[model samples]
Target: MSGIYIHIPFCKQACHYCDFHFSTSMAKKDAMIAALKQELVLRKDEFKGDTIATIYFGGGTPSVLTTTEINDLIATVYSNYKVIENPEITLEANPDDLSQGKILELSQSSINRLSIGVQSFFEEDLKMMNRAHSAKEAEQSIGEATKYFDNISIDLIYGIPGMSDARWRQNIQKALSFGIPHISSYALTVEPKTALATFIKKGLIKPLDDELAQIHFQTLYDVLTKAGFDCYEVSNFGKPEFYSKNNTAYWLGEKYMGIGPSAHSYDGKNRSWNIANNPKYLKAIGEGELPNTSELLSLTDKYNEYVMTGLRTIWGVSLDRIRSGFGEKYYVYITRQMEKYLEQELLVVTYGHLIATKKGKFLVDGIASDLFMINLG
Candidate 1:
């Protein structure tokens, strides 16, 4: 099965910690939508051979698009691609965009699921991150969204340095009380060139401590797991039947077509990404060029990707799949290295699937690297 992703490259404001491709100016909004539709038609046959099982509208902020825009985009994909019956269509929305009317409109659309970006439910954290939505709006939006949609997933950010451990517990409690199905919480990351980084350097904002992040992470796991949500992937938790299928497909290295600026696509044999610059992308695509770069995946590179993605979630890399797909020697070496971690309580082997233990989930990158088959040649 394949997936389709559309990136809506526009935001109402520049968020302090956001490095995502977006423009505060909506000058090119209409043109970008037209260009995105055109790009879909231009590359119609890229994944035409596979059945499209999922379609994800990620952002900038997908909810910024009007209901008419949302409908039209879905129409284009259906007209151009082979979509499966009842596909898991998801939209990454922000709280400020979700009103009762908009939620009602979304309920009638093909979007069966929503991934709401409700970073926190407190005004202090909202201001700290410079998020466009207020805490009241965030809470009300979740309530409103659930009235129309049952498969609602809200995102929360933790370890903000401004939010204390007690406050963090309250955040978790608020989400749990909301009765939402899925929760994809994250530790605050200080990316280079983002406002958070600049502020920390200027001493205007405190930096996130590793110890604080660790504590927050552990607290999140404990709270969510006890609340009957599976820690299906690190940083993602879900109640019964609420895991994100679209993201799961990506982590599993399933083929998908990404249409828009700064989006990436993978087809098992090759990987590609579009130019992040909005104007450049629109110009190139408008001129009938694909406006992207591609790379053929080598055996070693593919193996590394597999290890990296698998270790980050509850599904650890399957050595059997590696042997069949990569080769015997590489597969043997992967399991051999994983055996070392297996002894250290970092990974657990159960039902023939090696999963990272709770401890291992904390340092997933390191464990995945140990099992990774690098291109040392």
Candidate 2:
């Protein structure tokens, strides 16, 4: 089965380290929504073979949209795609927008899962990130939301300046204490052109220490693993039965269509992304054209991507699948390269699956790079 990803590109306030395509202005929201609906219809035949099993509303903050707008988008998806009976519908929201009333209203929609962005439950951290919500709101909102939706997920950022390792640990314990089933924790990366980068460059704010971030990540893995939360992906942990189906679909090489400005669409063979500007996207779609560039994946590109995405999750690259897709020689080269990591205790082979070890998960990208074939084609 495939999935649907809806990108809502507006935020209440800009975070220091955010690099995702979004705007703080709402002037184009209505027209953008209409354009997104048009884009959905225009791309219905992108993936014709599989039925949609997951519907994701990801964004600058999907919660910022009115309930009517969200439902209309879902209605459009239903009009074009053959969605499964109980598709996992997810909306990525921020703490400030999720009130008890809003949570209750969300329950009335097709959405069944909520991924709340709770970067930190501390006022100072919130201020540092220029987040619109307060620390108290972050803690209280999730507690209130759990009463309405049990299939909840939270996003936490670690390794921020002034957020101690102890504080990060407390954050995880707090999430578990609140009975949140799925958690997506991440390291603070100061992307270029973001506020954090400027501040660090000017010495206005101290930069994040890589070593400390690594320590925090190790602490996270240990605590979550002992708490019965499985590390299904490098940056995500979930209870035994709480794996994110939408994200799982992406990892498993399933095709999905993304709608809205800066959204991406991937069929099994081709990948495309819309322009990052809302006005540009809306204008193009209004003219009955999809505002995205497309490129067909070369065989080498596909193998490299499989190695990158697959190695980050529990399912490592399959040599057999490689042999089948890329031929016997490619598999032979990969097996020879994997031996070095296996000897270094970075990868473990069992059940015919080459899975990344706990130690390897941290360096998964680097390891995958080493295993990449020059010309799988």
- Residue-level lDDT of model 1, residues 1-377, one tens digit each, is 99999999999998898888888889999999999999999999887678899999998999999989989999999999988898999999999999999999999999999999989888988998999999999999999987888899988998788678899999999988979989998888898999889999999998788888888889999988998999988989988688899999999889999999999999889999999999999999989999899999887888889889888877777767878978888877877888888899989887767789987787788788878776532
Error of 2 at 138 (Å): 0.8
Candidate 2 has what TM-score?
0.97
**Candidate 2 residue pairs in backbone clash:** none
Provide the lowest-lDDT 10-residue window in model 1.
368-377
lDDT of 1: 0.89
Model 2 per-residue lDDT tens digits across residues 1-377: 99999999999889999999999998888887888888889988875667999999998889999888999999999999888899999999998998888888998888899999998877888889899898889888899988889799999888888778899888889888898889999999999999999999999889889888888888999999999999999999999889999998898899888888888888989999989988888878989998888999988889888988888998878878888987777778889999999999999887777889988888787899998878546
